[model samples]
Target chain A: MEEIQFWIGIVATMAFAVTGVLAIADRGVDIFGVLVLGLITAIGGGTIRDIILEIPPFWSENQIYVWLALAASVATFFAESFFTQPQIYRWMLYIDGFGAALFAIQGATKAWMMGFGLPVGPVILGVITAIGGGLIRDVLAGRKTLIMSHELYAIPVTLGCSVYVLILNFTPQYAIEGSAFCMLGIFAIRAAAIHWDLHVPKMFITKTR
Target chain B: MEEIQFWIGIVATMAFAVTGVLAIADRGVDIFGVLVLGLITAIGGGTIRDIILEIPPFWSENQIYVWLALAASVATFFAESFFTQPQIYRWMLYIDGFGAALFAIQGATKAWMMGFGLPVGPVILGVITAIGGGLIRDVLAGRKTLIMSHELYAIPVTLGCSVYVLILNFTPQYAIEGSAFCMLGIFAIRAAAIHWDLHVPKMFITKTR
Candidate 1:
């Protein structure tokens, strides 16, 4: 189970790094800036989660995550041109959704294990862990943050987190399975939203007076 | 001692809230967004500091900070027009410099109290606590962060924190006096920079290719 968690984390880190690179590709940021952005995007969410949980940041404890993120970022910086096709972009989105799902579930589980109990705090932590890196990346790249956008980004993560916490509360024995189920659910919703161009409704938005 | 720290924190919170409001006032964000930006700017740095030190976030433990920040934001929203005078703006800058200085010293002292030890970690935490809130505010408002700009914003905080940590390491009995000295130093440098429109030179800048 620990090994599975480790690999999932690594994959998520790499996926987010790619997303970061994609975000800043045409922004005229320098190579060093690009690497920094990728590192921040890959590690930012989990770093915030660990800090809020009063644990040492995950990347600080183990150099593997940092190294992997750096390597993935360097790769993406050089190879971003190859992924400009619409099909490749779509695939990247799908993979990003999958990674977000995994991160959301893992974050909720970690918070639960830390005795944050059911529902609110754990669910929020989960969402933060899933999207915090992307939010930071967007803000740094001078683009609209996912939370501020019309896109259906945070909702799927929120739903997955809430469900994961609920399942954990009711059936502690099925924790691992429940996590997997929640991840799949989140990924499906996010992928569908991407495919259909779904967005939060205008009525839900707060307008400037 | 605790009382002094509490009051200093409150003043800093209010000042940062005002700064946040000023940053987003003309950006077309609504009332709710303004409040969020203000609250985050006021508490954001301290929250980051506590998290890094594995302590409960300060605002979570005390509602006074939250209320004060909200009040400041609301007041700024309604009363901002009255402060358009250049004199008022200059006053705000001076107050902000003082708040930043106070925040820097307090953050270093808190980290030292928490056993973060001499030299590196505490000093870094100090600087983060001093500027983290402002950085978040600027990023959210889609403006350049202070650290990324030519402004001499972060240098004073860094110098003050380094001095505070060094003083604590050598003469523990002078901790309080050392903090005072550091705060004064930070405020003086920041004030001078604001007055003279000082900035980092072009030679130190990294250009994007």
Candidate 2:
């Protein structure tokens, strides 16, 4: 399970790096700038997660993550035009969903493994950690961040995390499997939402005006 | 001196938040989204600073900082349209200069007081902290991050921090005063750069290709 989690994180890093590179393809940013964005998008969320939990930043601890992000970044930068096609956007959305689900579950599980109590802080942090990198990427690329969108982005991660927490309370032995299931559930929902442009109802929208 | 730093931070926060809101003026984002961007622009640098230093996160200790960011965000959201007229972008550049100078000094000084060593690490962090928020803001807005432009942005902060560090080394008695001078220097240079479209020589540009 631990090995699965590690591989999942690596895959998430690759997806994020590629997404970052693709974002800047239209902007004609210098190569250095493009690579920076890609690497930042890849490691940013995990870095924040580790920092908040007072652990050594994950990228610093295992050099593989950094190298992987760099490799993904370089590959994406060179191949960006191919990935930016409208048809590929559909695939990108699914990949994003997969990455989000994997990160959300892993983040929550890590927090729990660190001896954080259930039902509150760790769960919130998990959702935050899962989305943090994407938020940063959107901000850097000059687009609307996930939190501000009407889309079902954060909702899936939140639901997955909550379900995982519930499962932990009921069956400790099956919690890992439960987490993976919940993660897949969130990913499927997100994929569906993207497929149909689904959003939470307007009534749930917090209006300041 | 501490009072000056606090007031400067407040002013910078307001300017950054306003700028963030203005950046999103025509993007069709909701009030919450605008607010999130504003708050992120205002406090994002300092948060990065705290994280790098391994300190208990600042906002968690005193929620006032969070409230201040929120207030600035709200104010920016409502007032942004008024300040984003055609000529406004020019004025914004100078106000942004002010923010850069203030944040750079405050960040460097805080790192020094926190016992981080002299010329290299803290200085780098100071510049990073100073420009970090704006960089993130530009990226998220789908524009080129200002720092990536061949402008004199990071240079001013670097020089200012060097001046401060020099003062701390030779004239410890006047360290605080020297830091103030450093901020003034950064402000002056930043203003000039905006006014004149100044940039460091091409030789300084790193070759990534």
Candidate 3:
């Protein structure tokens, strides 16, 4: 399971970097901008989580992630045609979803253990951990993030994180098992959403009057 | 000077919040989203800085800034026309510029004192402190931020911050006077950009060949 998690993380980082490269591919952003966006997307979420918890940025602890993102971005820059493949794009989504789920759970667990903002804070931090990097990426590239697309992007992660937090609150010893369970569950829901084109029902969505 | 700093911080918070509210005003985003953006823009930069420095967020130290941002966002939500007025918009630019300059100086000084990444890290942090929140705000709202607009937005803050850091490196005693000088310098450049439509020269622009 640990090895699996590591591979998922690697896939997530490269996937995110590729998407980041693609996000600004046509924007005429220079090479520097492309790399900056890629690195930000790959590590931005965990960075926010660590910062919110008053810890050194996760990347600073182990610079491997930074180097990987840079490598992926540079590769994407040179081989845009290869990365733009439809098969690679689809596989990357599942990889991205898996990473987001684990990231959300990890973030929630950290916040809960740290005892920061209790009750609602851990869940928020978890969601931020899952989606924050993508949000930063989209914003920098002026693209519409899945978060703002009124889709199922944020919901599954939020729900999964909430359940994970609740499990920890009630049964702390179940953290490991709960994390695995929630990770799969979130990924399943995300995959379903993508396959079925699911969205938040009208009642749950806030409409501007 | 202390009292002046206090007032400037307050104005800065309010100014950022108002702009936040305005950024998504026409996007059909709900009131909650507006307030969230407002609060994020008001404190996001310092939060990033603190996180990078491995400290509690500055807003977490003093909740007043959060309250001020909330108030400004609420006020803007109700009085959209008032905020959207041309005169108010014009005045807000200068106020925002002033706030950004001060924020950059403070950020640079903090990083320098803490001895983070030396020689260059503080300048980056200072620029991030000044422009980070606005970048988040624009990204959230899917608007073209001043940073990406090619108008003289980040350059002044970066240059001013570099100067301030240099002063701290050599003449630490001149910190106060140097800060004041840089503040005016940044604001002056920003004002000139606004008035005369200054831009980064074409030679500096990256072309996608």
Candidate 4:
């Protein structure tokens, strides 16, 4: 399970890094800029979480994630021109959703291990950690983030966190099992919503303004 | 002195916000994007600091800073083209230097008050707080920050932090007075470096193979 979590983290990092690289395909940014975006997409969340938790930044502690981001960025930089299709945005969304889910679970688990002691703060911080990388990617790419979208984007992670926290409290022996289930649940929900364009109802669409 | 600090903070916020707006001009970002960048540049450092200290975020308690950043961003957005001269960069450097110095002093003082008697951590965090916003701005803008430049940018703040910490230990009563002097010292050094294009000696310049 620990090995699975570690591999999932690496995959998530690479996915987000590729998303960042794809976002700036035509921006004429140099290699340095591309790497910066990729690194931000990969490590920005964990860095924020570690700093907020008053720990040494995660990337500085383990250089593997940073190297993975760099390698993925270099690969994407060369492969960007091959993405001739106009569905680039869709690809980005797919990759981003995958990364966010993996990160949300990993982050929550780490926060729990750190003795955050509550469902509320850990859940909130987990969501922040999950979305933070992509948020930074969007900010740097000069695009709107998924958070600002009309879709029920942040909901799945919130639900996953609630369930995980509840199970952790109620069944300590199955905490890891519950967390795994929650992680997959979130990934499925988020990916399906993105794929189907599923959105929460608009409170303003029915209004005659 | 307190009044001066207050005005300095306000002006610093305005300066940082304007810098963000200026960075956004080339990208043709909307009102929301511009405002976000401005607010990030204005309060991003302090946010990081508070989080690192495990304290509630400062801007949450006082919404005035948010309003100020919003107002400045809006004003800069509308009046952007008018300030697109090359000299704007020069002005930004000076304003940023002032802001960095003031924040460095304030952050160091706060850390001292929080009883982190060791000079190393507080002083380093002081410099981090001072330069963090600008670093974030550069990262979001896809531009290299002044820190990566050959100039003596962050070094001045480091020096200022050292002096402030020294004063805190040696002459506790004069700590406040010493902080003011250090602030001016940093501002003067940074302003001179910017004006004169002065930089720290590059010992590694010859090692570029």
Candidate 5:
């Protein structure tokens, strides 16, 4: 189980780093800037989660995550040409969704381990962990945060997190299986939303006037 | 001493909330959006600080911070007309500077109390607690972060924090007076920057090309 968690974390870090590289590729930023963005995108959510959970930041405890993110970012910078392909862009979206799902599940699990019995705690932590890094990336790049839009991004994470918390609270024996199921559920919903350009209803959006 | 800290925290919350309101006033966001922005701006820094220090978030422990921020934001929303005057704008900047200084000192003190003996720890925490909230606010609002620019903001907090940490380490008896002096130093420097539109030299800037 620990090994599985490790590999999932590595894959998610690399995928998120690639997303960050792709995000800033068109901005004409330098190599250092790209690396900074990549690191933030890869670890921002988990870092925020750890801080809020009163635990040492995950990357700060293990240097491997930092190295993996940096390596992936540098690799992505050199491989920018491949991302120009439309199919690769689609693949990136899938990878991003997968990473978000993995992160959301892990976030909820950590909250449970910390004895956050309140359903709201895990759900909120899960959503923040899934989207916080991307939100930071968008903010630094002066782009609109996905959550601020009607985009169907945070909803899947919230649902998956809530389900995981409920299962963990009710049936301890099924925690691992429940986690896997929730992760898959989130990825499927996110993939569908990406493919169909799905969004929340207009009435749900808050308007200024 | 506790009483002083309480009032400073309250004033800082109100000032930061007002700054948040002013930031989003022209964006055409609704009342809810404004309140969200305001609350984030007011508590974002301290929350980040506590999280990194492995302590529970300060605001979560006390509902007063939340209430104060909400009241300030709502008042600012209704009293937007008063902010049109140039003098009020100037006063707000001063208040913001004062609050930043106060927060920086308190952040350093908290780090010291938590046994952060290293000079780097307290200084980093102090700077983060002083500027972290505003950074979050800028990111959420799609504005460029002040720290990323050449603005003479974080530098003052860093210097003041370093001094406070140094004093607490070498001369513990003078810690209280030293904190006040450092706080004043930070506020004065920030006030000067705001008055003169001061910034670091262009030579230090990183160019994309």
Candidate 6:
């Protein structure tokens, strides 16, 4: 389980780096700025999660994460045309969904291990972990926050986290399976939302231009 | 020394809380959002600093910080028109400068005590602590980050932190005096910038729309 999660984190780091590059696609941020943005977006969520959990920042313990994100960001910068393609943007959306799902589960697992218990804290942590990086990227880019947008971004992650908490609370035996089930469910929901042009319902949205 | 620092922190909390309300002013965010933003803007910086230093969050030790911020935010909400005055915005800017100065010093003190050494890590931590909350507040509110603008914000904090670190390294006996001196210097620089419309100069600026 530990080994699998480690690899998931590695992949998530790079996926997030690419998304960071995409976030600043046309604003004329220089190369140095692009690299900094990449590193920040990639490691930001995990760093925040670790800090909240009172653990050493994950990148500080292992430099590989930093190097990988830097390298991925540089690669994206060089391959600007590939990223600009419409199909590639759609592809990144799926990769983003995958990373968000995995991150939410990882955050919940850590919070649970640390005895945060059910429902509120762990679920919120999960959602924060999942969306925190993207939020920072958009914020730094001066774009609207994901929560403020009409997109179905936070909802899937929230539902998946709640389901995981339910599993941990009621049926401890299926907890391992529950992790996998939740990750896939979150991803599927996100993919469906993107495919269907779905949005959060009107009641939840604030009226903003 | 610790006693004085604690009071500075309390004042900073209320100051940042008011700035947060001003950030969302005229945006039509409801009462709950205002309260939450206030609490977040108040504690977010110190919380980040503590987490990075691997210490328990400051608010976790004392709930008074939380209550004070909430109360200040509620007061601001009730007195919305008073806050809308041009002079009130200017006053908040000075309060922001004062709070930023103190928080930067506090962050540097913590990092130095933890043996982060000269000129690099501690300085970065200090700046992060001073600006982290405003960054979040502005980002969530979709405003440009302080660092991105030409405002002389981080520069003063950075110079003050450098002075603090230098005092710590060279003349350890005057460390407390150095703290006061640096805080005042930072606030003075920021105030001067606000009063004179000072900027970071065109050479250092990136061409962004």
Each prediction's TM-score versus the true structure: 0.61, 0.61, 0.62, 0.57, 0.62, 0.61
Model 4 residue A95 lDDT score: 64
lDDT per residue (tens digit) for residues B74-161 in model 4: 7887776556666876787689789889988888887778876476767977887787876776666555676776777789999999
Candidate 6 residue lDDT tens string, B75-144: 8899988877899878888887899998899888888888653445577578878888777777767667
Candidate 3: segments with Cα more than 4 A from true spot: A1-47, A54-113, A117-126, A133-143, A150-209, B1-3, B195-198, B201-209
Tens-digit per-residue lDDT, B38-144, candidate 1: 88788889888987787777665566887889899877777776544678867877888888999888888888887885568889888888889888877776767
Tens-digit lDDT track of model 3 for A85-171 = 887766766677777887888788788888766655678688888888878887767787654566676778888987988888898
Taking the tens digit of each residue's C-alpha lDDT, what string does model 3 give over B25-116?
A: 77665454566678888888988898788877776556688789989988887788787799998787778777888888889888988998
lDDT of each: 0.80, 0.75, 0.81, 0.76, 0.83, 0.81
Which model, 1 or 3, shows the larger DockQ?
3
Weakest 10 consecutive residues of candidate 4 chain A by summed lDDT:
A200-209
Clashes of 1: 0
Per-model fnat list: 0.15, 0.18, 0.24, 0.06, 0.24, 0.27
Model 6 segments more than 4 A misplaced: A28-37, A74-79, A201-209, B1-47, B54-127, B133-143, B150-209
Model 5 segments more than 4 A misplaced: A1-4, A52-56, A60-64, A116-121, A147-149, A170-174, B1-39, B51-54, B59-135, B144-209
- Model 6 agreement with the true structure over A70-164: per-residue lDDT tens digits: 89888887787787688987888788788899989989988888887455778888887888877777778776678788788789999999999
lDDT of 5 by residue, A59-178 (tens): 888989899999989988888988758898788888889999999999888877876535556775787788888888887777777645656777788778878888988987999899
Query: Over the stretch A28-70, how does candidate 4's per-residue lDDT look in tens digits?
Result: 8889989999889788987887776668888887899999999
Candidate 1 lDDT, tens digit per residue, A86-183?
78777878888888898888888788888753345578578878888887888878787764555677777887888888888899899888988999
Top-lDDT structure, candidate number: 5
True lDDT of residue A145, candidate 1: 70
